[model samples]
Target: MSDLTDLLTVPVLDRSLQGALKAALNGKAKPPGALGRVEELALRLGLIQGRLIPSAARPVLLVFAGDHGLTRSGVAAFPSGVTVAMVDTLLAGRASANAFARVVGAEVRVIDAGVAADLSGRTGLVQAKVAPGTEDASVEPAMTLAQAEIALLAGARVADEAIADGANLIALGEMGIGNSASAALLMHRLAPAPLGDCVGEGAGHSPEGMARKRAVLAQAAARSVATAPLEVLTQFGGYEIAMMAGALLAAARAGVPVLVDGFIGTAAALLAVRLAPNARDYCLFAHASAEAGHRLMLEVLEARPLLQLDMRLGEGTGALLAVPLVQVACALLSEVAELADVLEAAG
Candidate 1:
């Protein structure tokens, strides 16, 4: 595992970034300040990125797909095969994320972290398989520490490669049928709350499914409480969630801004924050999702999301939608005129 302290040393803000934002805000035009959240977002982006001219280029949307053994325990409404099918749909450019990425001019990269089904010879997918599937959480641990480390490293490596490939902005998304259960489990362990509070209906589960999910997660939490955070992750969290957390850490270290999507994404951000508290500096909450646990996760992270469209589509759709808003913020900050530049002296 990489040294968490060393990874956390990246600068989150600098004078150049702040100065550029101030200059943009002071440009001649409307009132001293007219654009509210937009201007704030621009400045915040600059500060977090430590860049005078903040521009997200070659934005990459990383969708990590995996399957949880807990899915077989009747946690999710959808079957485990849905994960593989969705991965295929996403790769075929038929998913919501693909559509949004096409509309926003961003590239999408799908990684097969630990799909239970075979995806051999799949095109347009990055095969970084860590395991066939997570271990059955209802019976034993989800994954060994070694497996978890491998998955996390794969995610970090992907972020590094994306940066090398000219991707200046990163968005985290996931595709696992029972991931919300894993997320809730992680949240219950990491946050200062009860498991019931963190638990939610994942993938449109019914009341009974949610109840069973909570019960199973409670048991898993009890069994893993004695372990460290990473240990708990290896034992109970899904591979995609672990990878998403690693990606967030890598993005922070590489000085790239990160946009977080809904519950699954927020859960990863929460883990990232725990692993590297400074990583929070580079993260931007894209939106408030419709998922019940997502709001709690966002609250725990103390994030002010850009939109509240009540979206729960995961797949980084919310982040993709927020991309244009971020760009508009930058434009307003850089191009909009200040009163001084537009109004003549009192004469």
Candidate 2:
């Protein structure tokens, strides 16, 4: 959304049942607050569901893939083509995300937001191409406002489809070479974090490589002057990131609990929050990444992630790892036998 006010029609989570949800948690056999974050998570889920009975049981992970013009500038360790190749790998169900989805029993959905290469015939690919990719932000705005709009709309559509398919929990993920550079720029714009502090050795950049990235990104930031959130997204965001931002807002709009992945996905969530500050209430920060800037972004949002795995892998794998926790939280509220209920039945 160009202005977050435009998207305020998206419903905020109704907390009418929070009292009952918490009472249920406290009434369990364990002492009050004994379940720790588990109680908090369950209560949050109930608030989102608008009922004491909640379920994040049927979850879907959407992996948005794109190629970045900045990848041509030697910003990333791998070639831009790897973006497309990795999509193929994900479709083959051999990617790390796929393995983890199996662990959490979540379905994986891949969307081609703006991959540079032709992936027309690829089965299991959602072709929502905004462009082959955006122009190199170091040289020019990465995308037109229209392109950013398209990406945002496409992302929202993906979330709508997921929700339609019985998905109550959605995890965000992406594959875009040099997207880390894009994410770093997003952080510098939205937060007071210095550009150097936001820069990280994404995907194994060497010390020298990281310096080059920091320099290039500073220029990109200087070139970008848009104060509006969508304009900022157009200036420096990757297609996959743009879509994820849209998807996150859409998920929040649909009242679906979002399991946000690390770094790149977090950047998307960051953009969504900037567009709609209330969207933050809908997201569950999945984990903190190994990336240095990740903590900076997390701090900006005041997000406490569920896991501290030093992982920088971007395929929604981190978010997938957190899915079981969500399921267990749902089970705690929906299936766990309460102390009062047991005692009443025995009496």
The Cα RMSD in angstroms, rounded to one decimal, for candidate 2 relative to the true structure is 1.9
Candidate 2 residue runs with Cα over 4 Å from true position:
1-8, 344-347
lDDT (10s digit) by residue, model 2, range 241-319: 9999888888888888999999998889888888888889899999999987998899899899988899999999999
Candidate 1, 164-240: lDDT as tens digits = 89988898889988898888877877765677888776668777877888778777777766435687787778899
The estimated TM-scores of all candidates read 0.93, 0.96
Among all windows of 10 consecutive residues in model 2, the one with the lowest summed lDDT is 1-10
Instruction: List the pairs of residues colliding in candidate 1.
Output: 27-337, 27-338, 28-337, 28-338, 29-337, 29-338
TM-score of 1: 0.93
Taking every candidate in turn, the Cα RMSD to the unseen true structure, in Å, is 2.2, 1.9
Q: Give the winner by TM-score.
A: 2
